[model samples]
Target chain A: MSSKSTTKRADALRSIEAIVQAAAECLGRNPDASLSEIARAAGVGRVTLYAHFASRAEVVDAAMSRALDRGNEVLNAVDLTGDPLLALERYIDAGWHLVDQAQALLAAAQRELPAGRIRELHAGPAARVEALVARGRAEGAFRTDLPIAWLINVLQAVMHSATEEIRAGRLNPERAASHITATVLAAFTPPGIPVPEPRGGA
Target chain B: MSSKSTTKRADALRSIEAIVQAAAECLGRNPDASLSEIARAAGVGRVTLYAHFASRAEVVDAAMSRALDRGNEVLNAVDLTGDPLLALERYIDAGWHLVDQAQALLAAAQRELPAGRIRELHAGPAARVEALVARGRAEGAFRTDLPIAWLINVLQAVMHSATEEIRAGRLNPERAASHITATVLAAFTPPGIPVPEPRGGA
Candidate 1:
């Protein structure tokens, strides 16, 4: 509550981010590595690392939390109100934009920790997208067979994969994101439902 | 050209599959293990292993190649003639199925082989998917801004991630695949396009 305490807390938070960033870098390079090495990457003594977090497991969890926070921020802000499906396009674009920033560390983390809570955290945008899917389905915009959660699960996987491809230089990020969005839409568009051109009323 | 040669090749291919499967098991248990140990897991003598594949890299590649072949089969059999979009859905579904079979080895191999030709050899499905996207765009069913190649890349990555989530037990395969397909679809479906749910129309 006091200035000194606040200062210390801020410093601790900064240190934690530093540690997570370092671990992310290390994990990116060596998916199979030890905790001590991660500590070295973070530029802190093992004891200091231990003082903040108890074990390698804790550090990983913490780093994942930070990563998820960044990922969720992107998912959370997607505008989903207008032209429901097209709104979803903007949402996907938002995700790519967010992912672009933490691309390297995030890819490594996703690869090593596929089902971790980081994914759960990234599920934030997913929830909004699901709501939109349900609306689309109920309103006859999306496939009714695509139950809400199932839809999110597939897209989440696709988003992660798309990010990796862009990072690997095999695909351009913007183009990849757009194509993925369109392809997925085409797959789920209930047969007979042809997409209208931009701003044309269906 | 003889029956004996055909049998020999079949036997050799089976052996390689076993070897790769064993190597995956080993990597799952021990990420930093060596080839001699993998040979032991495969029940092949180290000399015989070398005879079949010159190095660890080759063995890994062959293992991935086997996995890639399975993926190729799934893509090849998917009927793309009907609704270009329905074909797309079946293809994505097939992808979900295939990624389940040898995903662990794919993961381990991908982690190590960044510059690998895994994508090049696996481009068969990508090309088809790209064609579908082009078709959709031309049909006014998809976005003109989306790049065909990048869409394939992202979908491929997400497919891998979703499969791993299923393997990890955090996500049910059915639910995850459906969710992924929907989200990706939302992004891809053109603004105001009506997805036809034309019943009884595979």
Candidate 2:
């Protein structure tokens, strides 16, 4: 990308991210919180907020767009070893932590986040994760003939939901993540995969 | 078991449930929505609110106490079909619809609900669900070797978060529940389970 184009791109991304994050926090207080609330939180005047976002729905859509980007970043960064269960745990941990950091905003993103964009973002990484799971299944490290898509869908839920629980103080972060990981693996890992001993080896 | 005892128990349960549901609706609008808010929403005066709940925390706890009961009801009502995926779907669908009926209160409950009581309530149904999932893995319906606790924890997340989505209007009720159900099942079902073609074969 040319420097001018790159600079414009960077600035646009930054502005968009700030607006979305602010909106997320604003909406966290109330899903129905007003556009002015988002404007104030984002440090943008009404003109600026409107300059970037045309309406509440657009603002929500933009916010969701950024959150998905953040989600994808985490998905990319997490290490995925051959074991589907292990990779899933790491993925859930990374994903939840990302959402937790952005919980105020991500809270709103889940509902308004565009499915088409999310699916596109997920397509590459989800495929890789599925491949890992498939390999594990083939090797009998995970269950064979299990629906690969189901496992992926549930992991997304686990990460997304566990973060909410932690944000709400219903679960400690580590325990919450572990709890989700375990819950999923139990349903999917091959029959002989031993249940993880309870933390602290109790 | 006597009719008098049963009637009294029924009354307690109904009153408590009503108060909590009302409180939850208020909390949804305002995180800091007060005992007075809850009282008004519950359609009881402050005096009546206190008659059932001793404090704001108590109100939240009482409400969660009821919510946890409902969660169990969802768990118990899940049909245990030979196909774990189908059985799980029924469980999710039942729970999915109940989430937003009191999401704000649920969000609050995570903070104020009594830990000991909540933990106790969580343990029973959680185990049963885990057992069902474990059987799914053993019978080759789901991925094997994942932790049961984790699955249960994440299930709560998807259920509650979807409520946020629907309330925010990002997802319509039918689509939100279907998306969540499909996503969750994808996470656990064995690889052979096909992603249900969107719109049930259109």
Q: Pick the candidate with the highest lDDT.
A: 1
Q: Indicate which candidate wins on TM-score.
A: 1
Which residue segments of model 1 deviate by more than 4 Å? A1-43, A54-57, A70-83, A86-90, A111-114, A123-125, A135-141, A174-191, A196-202, B1-42, B47-55, B67-97, B124-145, B154-165, B168-193, B198-202
Maximum-DockQ candidate: 1
Q: For candidate 1, write residues A1-202 as lDDT tens digits.
A: 7999999988787777778888766755565556788878887777767788876656666666676676676566667886667876777777767666556555445555545555565566666777887787777766666555455655565666666666677676556555556655555576556754433211
Query: Per-residue alpha-carbon lDDT of model 2 for B34-109, expressed as tens digits?
Result: 8877777766678877777777888767666666677777668767767776777776667666565656666676
Q: Compose the digit string of candidate 1's lDDT tens values, residues B82-127.
A: 6655666777777777677656666667656655476665677668
Q: How well does candidate 1 score on lDDT at residue B126?
A: 69
**Candidate 2 local lDDT, A113-184, one digit each (tens):** 555554564566677678777776777766553355545555566666666556556676766665666556
Sorted into a CAPRI-style docking class, model 2 comes out as incorrect
lDDT of each: 0.65, 0.64
lDDT of 1 at A95: 71
Single-chain TM-score of chain A, each candidate: 0.73, 0.71
lDDT of 1 at A41: 81
Give the Å shift of residue A152 in candidate 1: 1.3
